[model samples]
Target: MSFASDNQSGASPAVLNALMQEFSRNGTSYGTDEATKRAEDKLRDVFDCDLVAYFVTSGTAANCLALSALGDPWGAVLCHHQAHLLRDESTAPEFLTNGMRLVPVAPFAARLDADAVAAQIAAMPDDRPHNIRPQVLSLAQSSENGQVYTPVEVRALCRVAHDAGLRVHMDGARFANAVAHLGCHPADISVRAGVDVLCLGATKNGAVAAEAVIFFDRTLAREFPERMKRSGHLLSKGRFLGTQFSAWLHDDHWLDLARHANEKAQALATALTSINGVRIAMPPEANEVFAVLPRQVCAQLGAAGIGFAEWYGDAILPDKIELEREILVRFVTSFASNETGVAAVTLAGGVLSR
Candidate 1:
């Protein structure tokens, strides 16, 4: 019944079963195990391309290690102002890159516009001696405000970054949701869109704790293993991570789980729209629903033990919009969410409105 976050939902049954099966088997330590190889193969097949995949325990490690590889200590990684890497990671990216700065750019609907990115880059100081050069452009696939970026948009941004001598990285913590919503191959929007590196997340959608830092550009990833090891992100018993990915990617289960979450989010968003004094703050993309609710309704939902969070960084709202007696909140649906939970929240909102 929790609409707090997709991570609040536990691992998918398939992933958990795979973990149990791998627990009893003997395999090599580190990432050299056969299971790890199989997981890499599965990912290659899923992406429809040959690329390098490194499994890590958390999205933070994956993103930090990937960015560290793409940028130098004196470089900057440009991204949306509301991105998790900029707002939530707590300087891990800077720490991993030894001093790389995260430069916030123009954020529209929580997505970075290519023109805006170009303008931001163009406005940076050209004094290489004293200014940090923009090295990497990091885009969140399903942005923090629950908005998804289309393939064309991603390609345009990548082109802008690459033409400016900046490598592109995608913080794909909710990549499956974006892919499922787009109904396109994962490679089409990311690898083929000229993304140099991708932090593919599995923990939020269905896995217990598995995240992959995928390198579409081989050159950018040549020394990533060293970076991962130095950052202590290399798990000794790596088969556990492999097993989870193997099961999650098997038969396209990852997309199915994401599709379910996305569908639930849509349902919740639709329900909220029918309530008076409630307004959807952003497009209900992926598994997150952002909405502005009356203060009384928010208090009622909170008192009823319904799980959600107060979202403060909504970029979609106009500056002139009145917020005197209302607040923006985010409701996240996961593979485990169902009609019952969604209905409960909406029904409460309706009752509270009366």
Candidate 2:
């Protein structure tokens, strides 16, 4: 059983078929092809709003360029301390924004705490020439900690950001899963809730390498095309990226893929909770399950060839984890997860642990 990451999974059959069709045809370069237009139109229908969509190959490129569009080079983008931009992106934001600061705010379960967000913004005012102005607030839906933020929570954070004259951005690597888990309309947590831009991701769900930077507030996307083109992210063979997204969104395939993954995650969580001494790190809201596994249990799983990640971030409270004997671990389920296979593994472990 492999629960290492969704990135480890291959492209779904439907996405692959769509790509193969595009491979046989000749198309215009630089995102001017029919596939790119279709993908953008479908995305606008998904959100039920008029939006500017730019297809990019990677979420990192989508995030950095979108942030670069919203914030000035001398300004700052605020995000959770555990956010991908602040921790995982490796200074791409700094490079793309041309020296803008990535300020990490205190995190609540790997999410931005609106109160802390307000306080942090208050500390840096435009009136102070020496202080870096906060120009953007980026939130990771289905946060790095594997917790999903609800629409109400998103609206509150967005309200705080907008009140401070800062545009809000969402790192939506798991956006599909978040929507599936919440059973809410895609617009509820995005444009309707005041998000300025979203980095819509599909590669982590089922596509090969498809990501879209959607501008819900078109004003924020004024210079984004140049930013994307200059960064070498605007693919010349762009239809491949476009076709993947087009297929991913059609027939509600993206939601189906996400729902299956989420179902498997919940199944894994339920199975693990029955094991003696094993604790659910947080109630999983999406496709990721975090657990505090006893040391014996960890060794046993490893010996059995089950793969997972050892988590050490502040996503879970230290007091809740028994450092002396228990280890914090993350198990990520994907569209490729076989429910019966994973269930068998966890069920056997539960019996053995008891």
Question: Compared to the true structure, candidate 2 yields what TM-score?
Answer: 0.96
Worst 10 residues of 2 by lDDT: 313-322
TM-score of each: 0.97, 0.96
Give per-residue CA lDDT, model 1, range 130-216, as digits (tens): 888899999998988787889999999999999999999999999999999999989888989999899999999899999999987
Clashes of 2: 0
- Give the alpha carbon lDDT tens digit for every residue of 1-354 in model 2: 789899999999999999999999999998899999999999999999999899998889999998888888889988887787887899899998898898888544456778999988887666657778999999998788887889999999999999989999999999999999999999999999999999999999999998999998788788777887898887899989989999999989999999999999988888877778778877899999998989888888888778899886456453566678989899999999986758766666766676
Which portions of model 2 show Cα errors greater than 4 Å? 107-110, 125-127
- Residue 101, model 1, lDDT: 93
Clashes of each: 0, 0
